[model samples]
Target: MSYPAVPRRSAVANAIYGLFNPIPFGFFVAALIFDIIYAKTGTILWAKSAAWLITLGLIFAIIPRLVNLTQVWITSRRFSTGADHVDFWLNVVAIVAAILNAFVHSRDAYAIMPAGVWLSVLTVALIAIGHIIIAVRYSTDREYFHG
Candidate 1:
């Protein structure tokens, strides 16, 4: 089966795409690092807040765009490689989990709910993986393949 040609992005657009592309991943990595550091230093409050920040960041800023882009990426990959369903579902679940975590963190229950923090952290990790996959797949120079 033939795949449609990928559109050529302008330099500015490419840079913006590259910058926006890794936001989810970066949030995840930061959350994880903060969690580990806080845990080692016995700063549970900071750890929890960092995890909440990551979750809120994803829910408010990243997840919606991520969902849209992921859908496009999945469709393109399926069309181009004839690949079966992959981790797309996992990403969706992570988005949902992050949303839930954000909701919980916004409430008074967050102070006592370690599970919520962990779930938020896990969601970030999953989203980061999803971001990495999409970035690698789409951000490459199309000229290499087209030429």
Candidate 2:
């Protein structure tokens, strides 16, 4: 079996990636806030707006991080390394939760708004924060976090 070569990234590139890493959470938080406002107002408009924001955030902001994960996975396919397992599952949960919330919001999903808010906060926000922390901690050029 052949492993794909992982290209070395410069510190500037890593820092840039680190900066971009949190943007999804930022938008996810915005969506959560918008959802809260919708819940408080009992209006579909805010919910719909939040859904779109989540969709956009997931597509543009979070997707790059997912791609980076793929790159890292190829570099180090070590899922059973407990930490790796947790991180992998968290990322999966985050994506699934975000997509689920967006779908529900767009289609008037019947779940409680607060429940959705909690899900976003727990899964999406937390996972993104984890990424931000890892990126910042391992921002050095020679080796990315897999060290």
Candidate 3:
């Protein structure tokens, strides 16, 4: 029996995505740590730093996500998987939280307190979950054969 052809990923796109995907995670994770520090110390500097970090992370996230969006949803039908869909939604939600956290961080440092910190936590957690899904989706060792 012959199987239908599967769409192969472009090497350039894959390379670009692999190179850029982890960058936003680092920035967002650092932002979460900074948010926690601001909560503890009530430091305006920490709040400002976190806001910058979140902004940078969002910017960095654009490249990999755009690549993924095109590959998974727009350009290729063969590539769709449940984990890909889940990861995509998780990233969308995380980005929203990060944007809200940025706005919250714009307020007085003390005023930002729990909400800003909590938003950061939410964003980081979502991003982490998304990453985990991607990792597991690709790392599985099992193979299936159709007859």
Candidate 4:
């Protein structure tokens, strides 16, 4: 069924969204780097930092992404059919993986990033690759949101 079109957000709202949109990519990179350091050095500090960054990234980027899907559908009044359709699910899976990963750090001196941590980082990377592909393949697609 068709949905009603929502009014466009104000300039301030758009500005705020612009601020939030690119956060996950940076956080994902930071988390991976932290995890790698922990894995290689067996440092609990790095492990705990990775866990905290992942949690923050999950809150700041992934959750807002889901909310953006609703915002776009509301403002545009229709679901996107091509790359955006696939992008949505990719993001969902990555976000869920990240949430699980955020809880995998140990509360001890030993660096303990469990399998879930790697899974989260990998899924987020996959999501990154997916967006890159979409950008390259559909550079002119009007409906595409550039992250």
Instruction: Give one digit per residue, the lDDT tens place, for model 1 in 16-59.
Output: 54566456656655665665565456556756666566664674
TM-score of 3: 0.89
lDDT (Cα, tens digit) per residue for candidate 4, span 41-110: 8867787787788777877874557455765555543534456556666777887777667656544545
Question: Which residue ranges in model 3 land beyond 4 Å of their true spot?
Answer: 1-7, 141-147
Q: Write the per-residue lDDT of candidate 2 for residues 49-97, one digit (tens) a residue.
A: 7877888778765555655565456544542233444555666678788
Candidate 2 Cα outliers beyond 4 Å, as residue runs: 1-16, 76-88, 109-115, 128-147
TM-score of 2: 0.64
| RMSD in order of candidates | 5.5, 6.7, 2.6, 5.8
Instruction: Name the runs in model 4 displaced over 4 angstroms.
Output: 1-15, 77-79, 106-111, 114-117, 142-147
Candidate 1 has its poorest 10 consecutive residues by lDDT at 77-86
Q: Write the per-residue lDDT of candidate 3 for residues 1-147, one digit (tens) a residue.
A: 676554478899989999998999899999999988987888689889999999999999899989989888987746678888899889989989989988998887588888988998899999899889888866662332232
Could you say which candidate leads in TM-score? Answer: 3
Clashes of each: 0, 0, 0, 0
Candidate whose lDDT is highest: 3
Per-model TM-score versus the true fold: 0.53, 0.64, 0.89, 0.72
lDDT of 2: 0.65
Report lDDT per candidate.
0.57, 0.65, 0.86, 0.67
Full ranking by TM-score: 3, 4, 2, 1
**TM-score of model 4 (CA atoms):** 0.72
In angstroms, the error of model 3 at 89 is: 1.0
Backbone clashes in candidate 2 total 0
Model 1 residue-pair collision total: 0
